[model samples]
Structures are given as structure tokens and as C-alpha cells.
Target: MIVDSLDIQKEIPLWALGDGEKVIQREFVFENFKQAFEFMTLSAEYAEEIDHHPDWSNSWNKVSVSLSTHSVGALTKLDIQLAKAMDAFASQVNSKN
Candidate 1:
């Protein structure tokens, strides 16, 4: 599913991946670096499980992740699924810290 701007806005912290409109993006904020890394680890496991990788960065308490089904040249079910998994991981990390 192509994530439209409207849907993106409604979901806090998640934005349609930019990069010339070819991916899905989300930025998650945590209490500190430790929490952020924890989320990253969880996301990594999930990504590996599905064989869907993401472009991501982490600085202090913030983690930015971008997902794209490069082979398809657009956002697909995989992107949305990863986004949701990331969201879940973020919530889990936040609650612990």
C-alpha cells in the first residue's frame, strides 16, 4: 500500500519515506541512548526475520528508520508491516525506560 501524506500525518512519528518519494519513514524518540539502542536491536531481529531491511540512524535518544521495497520501486505490504513492528518495538522500549 502506498502511504499517502494524510495517513502519514495521522500516525505520529511516522512519515512517508522521502528520498524522492520512494520509501516510508519514521522517527522514534526514546528517553536516552540505551533505550534507543534497545529498540534498534528489536527492530533488527524483526527485520532479519522477514528479510526486509531498513535504512536507519540513531543519535542519542532518537532513531530514524526508512523502509522501501526497492525491488518494487514503491511502498508495499512489507514496508507497512515493518513500520508497525517498529512502532511496537518503540512502545516496548519506551515503557521500560
Candidate 2:
């Protein structure tokens, strides 16, 4: 489906996938930098597998990721899928420690 940017923004934090109108944001917190980095690595792997990239930053134990479908001008299934993948990775990492 051609997920419109407007439709995606209407569902903030839940389905809003992408930076601005094209980026999805996900914040992950961990007990320490080691754990945060671990999650980042896993997330990187997932991004590579799908060939969908994210803009992210790491500050101590917190990591923020933003996903955008640059090719599409707005949000799409790829963006949503990537965001879900990131959430899953964060959940798995958090559960481990």
C-alpha cells in the first residue's frame, strides 16, 4: 500500500514511521553503554539485511533512531517494517539485561 505521510503522522509513536514527514523515531534506553551498543549493532544488522537505513545517535545508555524512505517522498511499508524491526530488536535486547 502507498502509505501517505499524512496517515502515518496521525498515529504518533505507534505508526508514525519516519523523520519529520518521512522518518520514524525510536528511543532505546539501557543500563549501560555496552548494552546500548549491543542493541545498536543488532539494529544495524537488521537495517543492512533489509537495505533500509536509519539516522541514529547514541548518548551514554540511550539511542535514538530515525527511519525515512528517501526514495519515496513520504512514509511507506518499508518504513513501518523497519520501525517494527527496530522495536523488536530493542525488546529482545532489553529482555536480555
lDDT of each: 0.81, 0.75
- Model 1 alpha-carbon miss at residue 81, Å: 0.3
Put down candidate 2 lDDT per residue, 8-60, tens digits, no spaces. 56644554443456566768888889889988899889889989888889999
Clashing pairs in 1: 17-24, 17-25
Model 2 lDDT on a 0 to 1 scale: 0.75
Runs in model 1 with CA error above 4 Å?
Answer: 1-13
lDDT digits (tens) for residues 6-95 of candidate 1:
555566345655877677777889998999999999999999999999999999999988888888787767777788889999888888
Model 1: lDDT equals 0.81
lDDT of 2 at 65: 75
